[model samples]
Target: MDDNLKKLIPFALKYKPNIIWNVVFNVLYALFSSLGFVMIIPVMNVLFGEEEKVTKLPTYNGIWELKTYLNDTLYYYVNYLTEQKGAAYALYLIISIIIIIFLLKNLFGFLGLQHLMKLKTGVLRDFREKMYAKIVDLPVSYYSEKRKGDVMARILGDVNEVQNSFFAVLELIVKEPLTIIITLGIMFSISWKLTLFVFIFIPISGLIISKIGKSLKSQSARAQQENGYMISVVEETLTGLKVVKGYNAETYFKNLFTASVNRLYILTNKIGKKHNLASPMSEFLGIATIAVLLIYGGTLVLQDGSLSGGAFIGYIGMAYNILTPAKAISKASYQVKNGSAAAERVFEIIETPNVIRDTEKSIAINSFNDKIQLKNITFSYDGEQNVLKNFSLDIPKGKTVALVGQSGSGKSTIANLLMRFYDVENGTITLNGTNIKDIQLFALREQLGLVTQDSIMFNGSIADNVRIGKLNATDEDVIAALKIANAYEFVQHLPDGINTNIGDGGGKLSGGQKQRISIARAVLKNPPIMVLDEATSALDTESERLVQDALEKMMQNRTSVVIAHRLSTIQKADVIVVMNRGEIAEQGTHDELLAKNGTYAKLVSLQSFES
Candidate 1:
């Protein structure tokens, strides 16, 4: 609890100016409200026809006399108004005072909320932006181990909860304490004996309410986690819907989804029950205290006649006012505890250390020179076993090198390392004698193009998707790139050509079309280095041929790294490397590997038989 409070203080302090203004308005509001209650005393005396004389003037020490002076000034004003306009007009003046107090109360309330809205929205926006930036900058290994939907839920839902719940704390900070202080001051002035009783009831009620809020943090955390799981289930089902349908796994997925929903349902109900109990419990405690006060105050008035009917009635009003702020404090306590749970989740992502941070001395490379050297490089996704052990390779500028290997063989790891998605555990990968680690990541990636086996397309027009390769590319440039990638014919056939809207994930396009669009995108980038990770592996024979042609054209003159399972695709490569397990077992032209009858020859024979 202390840690959570500590975390919240910084965010709260960030908007201190707004909070100070909010506090100022809240103080004014409480002052007016308390003043309204006290004004009832004088108004009652007037109604009873008692002479409005100061039998006992309130005295003070030092500058404390200022309050008494203000009171006397107001009294003289009321007396003058009465003499000029009679008691009826005096009553009208008193009513006007009450109206002014209420008006000021609402005015200050509005001002407080205005500042609060600014603070809440600003914090929310900043939190979300920071969370997104952190998520993007994190190592790729982080996503591989964590659920995508869980991360999304933290960024969206949890952050929103923290915003709302934390804002509630701001309201309580001002309104609750101000109400308590003002109400106590008025009550003490009226009768310190009665005020002491009210104070005694407050702490007792607070103690009980605090106990209820104790469990809120843990319950809220569990509820948030369950929500993440539910989102994860939905995300997985959507992304794998095609596979699920093809395998007739509807019932299987249904059960999986149902389980997630059930867990979320149960946890949600628990959280709702816990949170909802706060209001009613606090209300019941307040009502009980009010009943006790009524009984106690009535007995005192009846026995001694020291307290008047009017004073007692006015006291009841002040007591009831105390209940409102007390209830709000209790509710706000519960909200803050629940918000702390959400804040914890959000802060975790925002504060996550970037494992792949660039060095301060890293330079930005505008162009590639010489060769990309991988000298004795070794790596592991999980640090237990090396994926590329003692691997040495040199990719020269303006040459294409294809790596052929079975699944789990270090083919993709090479691409991953080249792009600096993961740094090598040992050895140096250098470009033009400068270690890749010495280069800024963005500048390095900007110089490279990647076309994966599964070409991902976003929901947008053909032109919009192509333009992602280079943000400033013109329509003419997009068209020329499409032509080079052999995508112009199919794109022209679309109902709206370059303006045609692709559905979500390019669902409107066939596999072949998506691959061509991806190729067109790469062609537009025109990077000095290109990586083709089995670009045509997922396509049909006809689609594969077209995409392969596009890929070949895009690879021209670029330092290309191709990971291919199809031997025919790399038969004419400048060099062919065959990997077995994590080690390169063979390297040469395709003919050389086949002639040697090594792993590459066996792979070729196996693929031919399967085809």
Candidate 2:
């Protein structure tokens, strides 16, 4: 009845057939397990002559009298066998029946576990798929507000915790309750008064065990939260190992990581110590209850002569049988509490709202026409400070427009808004006079090509990375795009040409080579509009020259919005706009801007001074 448990209900419902089969097998297992304990009665009767002799066969009875009828039948056969063969023959028969009952019990238990495996693994598979889909659909702004490793922890570590702790006890939750119920039923049939005493002990044992694990959920939550921080530190350390080594800050990061893990270790020890207590505590309680039963049941048999020794001994056997499930159920209580903490964290990712999604009834666009326009737009990354205020720009068809700005001048933010990576606070970016917010998100993005300063690459072949621009592009198309980006010459020299493998994030290639391959990708997309965000700023002189040439070739005959820090790259742009403090300071031809001798001229002058 926990809400965390209910999170799995939708996934669990898909495997209802597995659930039904599992329950059926568990019922059989519980029935036979208790019946095997009942077999002790006939064996004891054979060994000790405690049952009365029966000379004639028992009469058949209706369902109401079936218990009495079966008891008489078992006794009649035992007495017959003892007389005709020997007491040893009857004892052999009882022992054989006990073996058969135990065999069936184990077989049923195995079948129950087999079906449960399907349910557990299936639910985990579906839930993990849903988790991944949600992660992929989340907007870029979501990651800006979250740590990569914290999100990774929810997907990997926390989901596994839900498996080990939450689904781990599902078997106990299913089988143990039925085992206890059936065992208690057999005990009550033998002696209802003694069964009543058992009912009192179990609930009391459960209550005591419950108290120790009450704080486990909160402790477990703290441990998982700390785990996210630890993973984040490791991830950041790996990602910026060059910077860390360059700055000689290894000890600082190491100490920071050590502190995080220390907190996690302390929390882990607390949860472990608390969870370990449930097993022994339940056992001690089970034994204590048995000691009471031993005194009380012996009085009924020896002093009062009201109960038979065989039945009383069988009652004791049944009472001890309850111990296994009782221990498991109590331990599972702790596990459920522990796993619920993990479940909450995983669900947090699954339930996060995706704000940057397509609007309802949004239409799709297949082609760009006229121009792309940003009209009276205001924007902010954080609500309090505006990155761009009342900004407007028009990128006309087949004309290149370059935005020149220093850092924090909102040049890249313009590119992001055009791409709709983040929606504006107050503005409309229109394509062919249609508001872009009214266009399908995928359609809008599909029509524009982007090449950023960082050339993001996957660990795959050169051809595979190029194909991302156009998934259906052939080898010939890829080669042509690479040539246009000035990358085909190098590609041809590799051992496998376009098929040569690139290491993680193109670590195998130089920055210039990586950027060219990225340009090749955008060239392959061949959209109506191109947005190049400082594509040549991070290169050496020779690399920048080559990449700059590739950018010029790719931008030909395409509407381009170029954000550049380097004035050299935008000298031939059809219109040059210099931005400062989120507004345009100047806009004209390169020669026209120099004549004005304002912000654009000043920017060019600074670069000349540096050179």
Clashing pairs in 1: none
Model 2: lDDT of residue 530: 96
What is the lDDT, from 0 to 100, of the residue 537 in candidate 1?
75
Instruction: Evaluate all candidate structures by whole-model CA lDDT and list the values in order.
Output: 0.83, 0.88
Error of 1 at 460 (Å): 1.4
Using lDDT as the measure, the top candidate is 2
Q: Write one digit per residue (lDDT tens) for candidate 1, span 1-611.
A: 34654576676678889989988988898888887877776576567654245434445555657656656655666666667788788777787888888898889889988998888888888878878989999988888889999999999999888887777877777787888798888788767777778888888888988887788788889888888887888898888889989999999989987987888788778777767887788778777877887887887778866676666777888888888888888888888887889988888877788877788999999998789899999899999888999999989998899998989999999999998889899999998889989999999898889888787999889999999999899989999988887789889998998989998889899888888888889889999999888877767787777767777777777889999988778876899999988888999987787889888889989888321
- Candidate 2 residues 416-530, lDDT tens each? 9898888888989999999888999899989999999798999999999999999999999999999988889899999899999988888888888898899899999999899
Q: For model 2, what is the alpha-carbon lDDT of residue 438? A: 90
C-alpha lDDT of residue 268 in model 1:
78
